[model samples]
Target: MKLRFGLQARFLVAMALVLLVVLVMLGVLLQRQRLVERESEALSSDVIHQLVDGYLHGQGRELATRLADNLANPLYYSDLDAIGSILRDQKRDDLVQYLMVFDTAGHLVHDGSAEIEGYGQPMGDPLAAAATAAAGPHVQATAQVLEVSAPIRVGSERIGGVRIGLSMAVAHRFEQRNAERLRGRIDELSQRHQGWLALMLLALLAVLVAAAWYVQRLLVRPIRQLAASARRIEAGDYSVQDHGDTRNDELGDLVRAFDRMSESVARHDRDVRRMAYTDALTGLTNRLAFRESLDHRLMLLRGSGRQLALLFADIDDFKRVNDTLGHEAGDEALLQFANRIREAVEKYGGDDALLARFGGDEFVILIQEGDVRASATRLAEVLVAELRRPLDIHERQVFLGTSIGITLFPEDASSATALMKNGDIAMYQAKVAGKNGFRFYSRAMDHAVERRVHMEQELRGAWERGELSVVYQPVCRTSDGRVVGAEALLRWQHPMLGTIAPSVFIDVAEQSGLIEQIGPRVLHAACTEAVRWMQLGEGEKLFVSVNVSPRELRRGDLPEVVAECLRETGLPASSLHLELTETSVISDELQAAALLARLHSTGVKVWLDDFGTGFSGLSHLRRVPVDGVKIDRSFVADLQRDPDDLALTTAIIAMAHSLGITVVAEGVEKESQYNLLAERGCDLVQGYWLSHPVSASEFTHLLARRMR
Candidate 1:
């Protein structure tokens, strides 16, 4: 295990090391002092011993010389009592160990004793031999005694020299006393130094402890607090409390920087959250935020008996605005739409209602309080009406309508995803019914949506599987009853679903963006078939009309596609006619006019199909370039029965002729209807009355018969 040395622990450890070093130094100092004391004591004892030894030696020599002088006189005079008296006196002093006097013959005359038993006898000891042989004084010393011998002489003449011995016991006793005294003094001084050194050590330790406490309080504690604050910040608590350290140090600067960083992080977090949940252009809650809110609300209302309503809204023809005015204008429209919807929901929907932009031109609203259906319906209606009002986008008045679909909780769906899906499905239904309206979600809508989805998936493979084909309906000149041209129609022969109507699958194709592919194939086939028809007719001019979907027209490549098809099939451009509905042409008249002008310049005629069915037929005729217009089947079906239809048909024919536009009456199923169209100078007619749409071989046979 690794040891973690924190700030406080490290500080204390450092102080402990310093204290240990101080202790070691103090111990060494005390040891040195002791060593010095011992050395001084030894030196003092040696000095004292030398002085005492010198003094003892000097005294011994002086006394020996004096005695020798005195004894020499006595010996010369032959007075033995004199030497004996001096020896006794030296012994009486107690410092002498022993004293002896010998004659020139080396005999002991006297000893330092009360009895003179061996007096006048010859001394046979080595001391007597050495003393008798000495010409002057001699000295010898041992551990216990000091011996000195002096020869006595009278007037420089040797008669009978007297020798005396002195003891060193007095010098030894004096040296011992002096050495004891010096050692006592050294011991006293050493004890005093030890006491002072101990006090100093205590003072140093106190200083070290005080320093450690100060460092821990001033530095370590604040650092620990900062560490704790950092931990809190790591845990996402950006609000850090002040440590209240007023020191102008690095730590203080660090604390201030941390506080500022916390505040900055908090601000950045808030900004990121807001950007994540808000739409940049609309300033509305975005799809992610809406989905999260929906899920949360659904979870809360799971067991609650209350109901919630989800309204999904989409802007109709939003792409037209973008294509016509630019994306900037489209953005302005969306912003205005969002503001209007927000106001509408707030005013009509209860306080619990929530609104969010579901991306692009789509928005969603949630209503959970009181009469969910009524409130949602009211809000949706208000939104549709309010959004229908023209918006000033790029300084132009642009009309953008909204279609809303409302789905109720636990009725249309039980989950957020299902509710959103159903709501979107109903919104598509509203768009289908008409723009600027609202619809409540229904199970039928869901089934229809599913069917459409299946059909779209199947349609992708239909052309490859040979299930799709083009049929031709002949159009005849009304006056002569002669076939002039044929309209090419697309048919889908599904293996499982039998034959499907163009009304059903063509819409599916448009919605799924498959028409862009399917429309070109149909155009190519029609042009190829029409080339054959032109061959059959020989010198006659018989054109083939092919219907173009609005999606294909909006692609801006339709003219190029048509030209390419004509070129590939070897069909004359004048023999191929492109038919478009009024809605397709009116969606963006200027662009449609430009596209049609391009087609016309290449000698391909453009016709308006389903003419009277749209809202702006006359306006489209004026704005869009077209060579002819086909009367819608609805008006032709009831032309004789409904006077209004009759009047509309006649008025349309007259209006077209006045504008130098050819008119074709379609869906005429009766001879009477054909006769009425002929009388009205409708120019051409095509319906089951003449013949139903047939295969290429049948149409070729018809063209051959017409040539005959």
Candidate 2:
């Protein structure tokens, strides 16, 4: 069936036709009025120009120029009164708005109108030495005025210029009178057609009334009902109500469909809530649900003097299981692990406990009431013990341990977010102290973390702020006590905190990922300083060793970063040594060897720092491509006092020598330790016993002394 015109379509078409006719009539009337006004304005402007030019010609150019110059002088107020009187007498049709004069030097000498504010100013642009009027009336302040300018001359010499501004009020008055007559004619014409137009509008209005009534019955009533029903549905009122549109039409079908959709939405709502709050893998509460529960619990426990404990539990070495087994096994392990935690919570935490899985192998447990230290500790121990049991995953046994961090509500933190963060920090501490343990949140930890966060922010701008500097500790030849090289130690001088130790900020930088940015800055600064030292005679052959963190080495760009620094500073790579702690390279020997090989390729020396202090032994050391080993300070600090330390240091130096690698002894604080290290065939020794770390300039002076 073909569709008929709706009530809305017919109504809009009738109204649009009427509006178009009305607009056309008004447009024609306006256009005719504009043309009449334009012609009248041009004629009036020409007449005004002739009057002003005749007045200036009668005054004579020399006398006019002199009078204008006097009038323009702001200091001569009496001259302005005289000029204003002369211009006022010359005005015939009350057309002149203002008058101005410019001297031969282009300085504005006179302004005659009270409307003009500035006098005795330079004329930015002078009209040619001729009479001319502007194309149209120019606006000044509020009213439109015409401007005409002519040269003021003495015989043949042009002395100045005179300008007259004519007001457009007279011309505008004539245009208004014509506009009024045209408007009256338009009104009479409109009155003549008013009856017909009204009849047409009345016919349209009758049709609109009829259509509106029909549309109200046929469409609008049902749509309004459906909207009301939708609002009820949105407000979670799912009960089916009578739609009241019983006509056998599409509206009736739509009402029925709407009823069905409300039922479906109600069903989906439950599923959505479950999906939002529950983890799919373990069917346990998710982070969102945990946070909600935590907030509710915190509100209830606030000021009650009652204690609540939040525990953050993490699986130990979960990544190893994922790597060794398959991802499927990892998923299975997480499920089993979550189940164990749930079991433990049931056993020790009682019915008041709320258990949630924070994704992956991490879970959280809340005890509504508990002893701050004692009860929380017992619950954590139970969970750790329960998680230790082997799980049968795909017929293979898998063992796991958990670390728990516990925080009390009123004591540790007041808000849900702070409580959760404190628990997380405590959990990290437990893992750090060794997994399969538990730690309670303490203020000391918060202070340390806060300090870390503050330092991280400060260290980001430290290099740019010039707060970081390199201090050189002299490295000497053990054989003859002659200086060979110096280790560059980084120091931070915080504006507020004074001098901060390297250990504190460096650890923060590594954790906060700022180390990547700070490392290259230190490297460049040290290289630049090293180049300065290398210029000195004794330090020319001396190498500057810069410490590199594991993060920097893992980036795979250390070679490029170091090379760039060397290239920019003109420091030979061979004279710059990159030092890495044994822990940095011992984890992945192959990757470390690749990185060291690249640096080695650049003619830079690589030293395994803190030797024998890390996990790797001499066999692993032989695999790493390094040029030397630095004996850890622990051994050297005790070298003279402890027989075992002395034996260990001697053996390290001997073995390193046998492998064609040099050995540097660090922390030789006492003369005895230094003498003993020298006797042990150590190649280089660096410690306070000889000289402490000094500033760049001071190191330069030390190099000069050694040369002398």
Angstrom error of the Cα, residue 578, model 2: value is 1.6
Worst 10 residues of 2 by lDDT: 132-141
Give a tens-digit lDDT track for model 1, residues 1-708. Answer: 999889888878888888888888888887898788888878887888788777667767887888787777767776667767877777776667777777778777677566877888888765667667888777667676666778777778755444444445666667778878877877788778778877887898788888878887777777778788889878978677655656698978887777777778878877887899998888889999999999999999998988999999999888877776678878888888888988888888889888899888899999989989888877887887788887887665666688888899988789998999999999999987866898999989978888888999989989999999999999999989998899999999999999999988998898789998899999999988887777764566899999998778777888788888878999998888889988767765667778888999788998999999875557557667799999999999998889999999999999899888999999989999999999999999999999999999999987777677
Against the correct fold, how does model 1 do in TM-score?
Answer: 0.82
Q: Rate the local accuracy (lDDT) of all candidates.
A: 0.83, 0.75
Q: Cα deviation in Å at residue 479, candidate 2?
A: 2.8
Q: What is the number of residue pairs that collide in model 2?
A: 2
Error of 2 at 324 (Å): 15
lDDT of 2 at 598: 89
For model 2, residues 240-316, the per-residue Cα lDDT tens digits are 47565566778788977876777788778777878999999999999999899889878887888888888999997
lDDT of 2: 0.75
TM-score of 2: 0.54
